[model samples]
Target: MIVAATPADYADRPLYAPIAPMLRRFPDGLPDLATLQRLLEASAPQAVSGGGRPVRFVPPDDALPAYEARIHASGEVPTRAGDWHDFFNALAWCVWPLAKSACNALHVRELAAREAAGLPGRGSRRDALTQFDECGIVVVTTDAEIPALLAAHAWEAVFWQRRAALRETTRFLVFGHGSWDQLRQPFFGLCAKAIHRVVDPAWLRLPAAERQTETDAWLAAQLAATLPTLTPRAFSPLPLLGIPGVTPDSEQADYYRDTRQFRPRRA
Candidate 1:
């Protein structure tokens, strides 16, 4: 079982250690644009094209128009203005290439579908969903009861009453750029929130520390193993605080209350 390293030990830990296996050939320090591009090419050669042209992730000066065009064209995710944030975002893209692509595709598909059905614009649902897509984690569980609890909005039962089941069956997959960076200095507001998905009948039985490392490693390997073959999931991204008994005025209250997209299972 892996032991939790002290904060002092974290000083020497590699920032990109989570996805090190996928980006196996990068240099030993913080990556520049060239280093990042090489890492991306090494991890997913199909994702990087246009030779020297800035296509996927560009600076905000170019990103504004790119984002606007992408809203219509579903091309690529726009990069933010800052250096560090954009770099983290690029790494997130590398880590969750398929999911990221799926998210972009869904955005385009939903827009077209809505227009064709004579439905109104996305308004706030699309915006909220995009925020979660950009900075959310997906928690997949193998236990049947946990999902039942989640569906019923039985927060106390899932999180507290059956806490062991939650620990034993959960696989937390990080997909957001902000969530990736927050791993360095995690806090309440920027704490890890997840989209719950149920998996097949299999359980993760491991010590806490070992489980954490194994989960990261497993996610990295999964990304490498299933890229072009990945299928879209019916992911419902909600905040940790949104769990029924966790908070009264949850940040995602409106999102959870909305029946159009998220149908809360009332029991």
Candidate 2:
């Protein structure tokens, strides 16, 4: 049974323990990215090459053009399959932080020693980063924000960003008016608005204690209708290792089984 709790229920615990222990259940959950990449190297190193798509780094000088072109090409415009990949690519930019971590992992492996100059800046791996951004990444998936996802295979970065920002009392105060839906157009805007619209800025300005109580109550209510796993956690419930793209069949799910999930079972 779902409880009557609001997001604050999970967000406002205490200075030391405001975040609860994440309840994650997956086949493989790496504590850190380095360990995860090592396992990938031994098991399915091909993933490093993006399933053989020939990933190239956007030259240090040309990275901006590539990224800018991508942003402009994917503007609120429509196109054929040839152009859809590029559009999806641009939409995935939000996952840059996670990808940055992975690239950092690679840099650590390639270089035996490092100078301050030798550190891997975002410059050296823009291509890999872009691809991961373009293709949907496998993250721990959840319900509260699922309605805002653009495609079944990919998630809406705005949702994760919202959840992250709301955890803090102060950030929640400033960004309260901004919802994840504002970042991407959901397939069902009416449904998303009906559900997410209920939480407004009025609730944001409540006393920390009050906000916690109210958010917990509200999220708890949402739990009844959504597949939301309450508690502090990583990205989501899935064992998201790195980037994961859409797979039509198991034969295609070659990147990371731990992160790749089958379609959610709908009753």
Candidate 3:
């Protein structure tokens, strides 16, 4: 049984490192909808959803349209009070507004296409998008070989053999808010769908905030261009625990040998 985490647990884990700055604002508990909206307005005044509506968090409304549609149409994110999932999602909007907006746009576009085509269900593109939204990690690197190793599922080779290089040349940024929620009580088999971006090594040297800004811009452009062609297969699977420093067990080379989490790639 998953015990929902409280604000007190926010700073206790490395998994929350990415969003620590934002999480610090509400140390007592989850922020209410008004607080979230104020944060959005202050932090990302220009932030808007796909349909150009200004992004604002509001209480959940059953009478509204579907979640994505509502966001696209009205930019109102239906946030459940005190819900960790919704809280992190709100943080994602503040941190990666461009990419998040692009994602919302793509979702609206895909849904419209499906309706026009008389499709009965959400198609593969939407499925891929949701998977990424819920559990995606963006692996930014200067080295192409590193992504190749990840794609090959060469856990030992990538996380152990080239560990130093991996640290120097690559950065793993968690993009999925659901993954953030899961990381509150991280488990062995927690894997994330990964998308790779090859960036200049110099870009990696910038401060965290600057790097995130660039990443948001680049990712938004990438998604705007390729979302139509994206499939779940386009992502590489990454065992979060296998990353160096994510867990104490990962310090030793033997940790990568656990096939349960580091399954070998099928031929």
| Descending-lDDT candidate ranking | 3, 1, 2
What are the models' TM-scores? Answer: 0.56, 0.20, 0.94
Residues 52-133, model 1: lDDT tens digits = 1222654345525435335345334455533445666777556655455545554555555668989996744345446655
Error of 3 at 5 (Å): 5.6
lDDT of 2 by residue, 1-267 (tens): 122122222222222021222102112321232332333344223332211221222213343433333223222112122232222221121112223223323333323232445855434233332322222122112333433442332322332333343233122211111122121221211111112322444655665446544443343244333322312211122211111211112123332232323222133
lDDT of 2 at 178: 18
Q: Could you tell me which residue pairs clash in candidate 3?
A: none
Candidate 1 local accuracy as lDDT? Answer: 0.49
Please identify which of the two predictions, 2 or 3, would achieve the higher TM-score against the true structure. Answer: 3
Poorest 10 consecutive residues by lDDT, candidate 2: 172-181
The segments of candidate 2 whose C-alpha lies over 4 angstroms from its true place after superposition are: 1-146, 150-153, 156-198, 219-267
Ranking by TM-score: 3, 1, 2
* lDDT measured at residue 265 in model 1 versus the true structure, 0 to 100: 48
The lDDT for every candidate, in the order shown, is 0.49, 0.27, 0.86
Error of 1 at 226 (Å): 21
lDDT string, candidate 3, 1-267, tens digits: 244346545754555656777777776778888888888888778899989999989899899899999999998988899888898899889888998899999999999999999998888898898899889889999999988899999999999999999988988988899998887778879999999888888988899888888898988898778876898888899999898877788988888998998999999
lDDT of 1 at 95: 60
